[model samples]
Target: MSSTQQPQPVLNCDDLLELIPAYAFGLASPKEQQQVESGLTTCPEATAQLADYRRMQDDLRESVPQIEPPPALEDRLMAAIAAEPPARRRMPQVHRAWWAAAAAVVALVFSNVYWISRSSSAPPKAPDTNSHPILVQGDSSFVLTSSREIRWVRLPSAQKNTDATAVLMWNVESEIGLLYVRGFPPLSAGKTFQLWLTMGDAKLSAGTFQVDETGSGALLFNVTAPIDEYTWARITEEPEQGSSEPGEAVVVVGEL
Candidate 1:
């Protein structure tokens, strides 16, 4: 059997010129993309226009000079950043139900961990069958406020800063924590100090902070979870932009 096939029409340059910009910017539909591509092969004017558009985009991007933010805007941004809390730690590859169940079990074991003894609106105490949670041990300045279930742990110097010492005070219920560090030398240029919480199999960033010339600094960090559920803490030196994981520079280490 013999059948005659009709030839497809050639798209002219005038029509292809209008669609060229859309194809270059990825805004062309499938049909338009096919038409413009076929037209570019035969129309030298359309091809040159496409190349010119590409060059123009590149030139526009490269021509802009770097501009630093104004001092007042930078200050406001920094102030806003300081007011916001650090992100919560994540247990990668763990199921969400497992996290809830674990939290429940910890709450059952340490029932009195959230007892704000002095608060008038505090809830009636649950039968605290287990041993009492960590309380205010001594008259230390590390704990700025009087809160229940406060864990005060001494962090001694680690591998990096031998003279540095730190103390951590955290409230289990309120999710408020404080860190007091002393005797740390100023970090080198582009280096920053960060606090990390070791919770279960995950390590979470508490926040980054800076110390004075004498190596004394204090940071107030907040966590959405109960701080007492974690067992360990570490102060490490990280890049100025921050890190997803801890580095080898362990300045102060403690068990909470």
Candidate 2:
């Protein structure tokens, strides 16, 4: 039997250096954000670049003059409010001692109505199905639901490929998914492909694998978090030991 080949370095220091500004500004994807953080830990030069960007942001803020609104603005606003119809204006004054007490009651009523309307108007949250027991099949495939309404996500290649294709099928309720890739070049020495799940500003690793000589690969991952919480899945090339963070070399991306 043949041994598995190790992954090679696909991205170098210079490539990561170019991504620092985007990473610092929170414009980079979660995977890229992880890469920047990892680079900062290993490379002093990347760390200095990050510090420079931070200092520049601070300097930009300091350069702007802090302007305050005029003190009379509040009084003028109150005068306008007083001029409006009673329905739009502040409540009429009761006896001076009781005014505060009456105002508090009005505020309480408004607060209750506001809360009731908000509760009724807002959409209900999706149920969390992660706690439910999963079902496994004889083929080793499992699903979260008996009906198994699977969502198919087509992953776009970083390099345009008419022949290359990748897809992910997952049940939002089950959070169990499979990734299939075809017509991708096998990794070079010291390089491996890693998968990531992105949720808002955070990214979590799904796992890693290599393609066969035919340029085909597959991965089965059980999402630990609720599937609704994640936004996308991404694949990137990294070194044999694998990266704690993703590199700039994105191979494929699929929206969740």
Candidate 3:
């Protein structure tokens, strides 16, 4: 009997866009990177989007400060785990239900003991307060605070709007940032989306982007000046090549 072979799944433009960020960052698997490269040759829109993402990746590498983790961090963590009581390390071979109950109790006791010890020890050093707060959407509760050199902000979708989502991660000190967007509507021919960094009355162009059928796109740009200087970021509809100034058509707006 002859057996039929199953066809492999084909990635569309939207699928390729989703992988663009990873590809540009060299985080994509070899197969995925090859697929993105192949897609770029066939899709002009994907090609343009890849170019922008590559530029962003380059800027991110140059601008973001890299610091090695404390050498003793892992050793300390391992020592702490080793210091836990030997009784806690030994688990009785009981029935499944009894095992679950015992596990829960052990977890509670261990956590309480660990916290108590930590509280009695020397006070930990304070984190850097000058880190840039990444505000997602308009919600202040979801802010990401980093003690490291870079500060990342994940922006949420507009109120009552389920159509799109965006994330902006950057190191204000390094003057480098990356914006990844998904679920925005695809533009018509001869039209594209433009990103603007608003500073008081002045609005500077970050770069332009185009989404796939599923509304996914990304942009990487270097902030020549301090990010604090820019108060707002917004995406607007513009001509294919983009415009010097933002047009009246606003797609999405976010506070920096």
- Measured by lDDT, the strongest candidate is 1
Please give the lDDT score for candidate 2: 0.61
TM-score ranking, best first = 2, 1, 3
Model 3 agreement with the true structure over 93-132: per-residue lDDT tens digits: 3332432332233224232211112123332332234422
Write down the lDDT of every candidate, Cα atoms only.
0.66, 0.61, 0.59
lDDT of 2 by residue, 17-82 (tens): 988999888798666766665566567787899899999999998999898989999999999989
Off by over 4 Å in 1: 1-148
List the lowest-lDDT window of 10 residues for candidate 1: 134-143
Residue 43 lDDT in candidate 3: 69
Which model, 1 or 3, shows the larger lDDT? 1
Question: 8, model 3: CA deviation in Å?
Answer: 45
| TM-score, one value per model | 0.43, 0.44, 0.41
The model with the greater TM-score, 2 or 3, is 2
Instruction: List clashing residue pairs in candidate 1.
Output: none
What TM value does model 2 have?
Answer: 0.44
Tens digits of per-residue lDDT for model 1, 55-152:
99899898999798787998898899899955433332343343233233323333333322233243343323332322221221112232223446
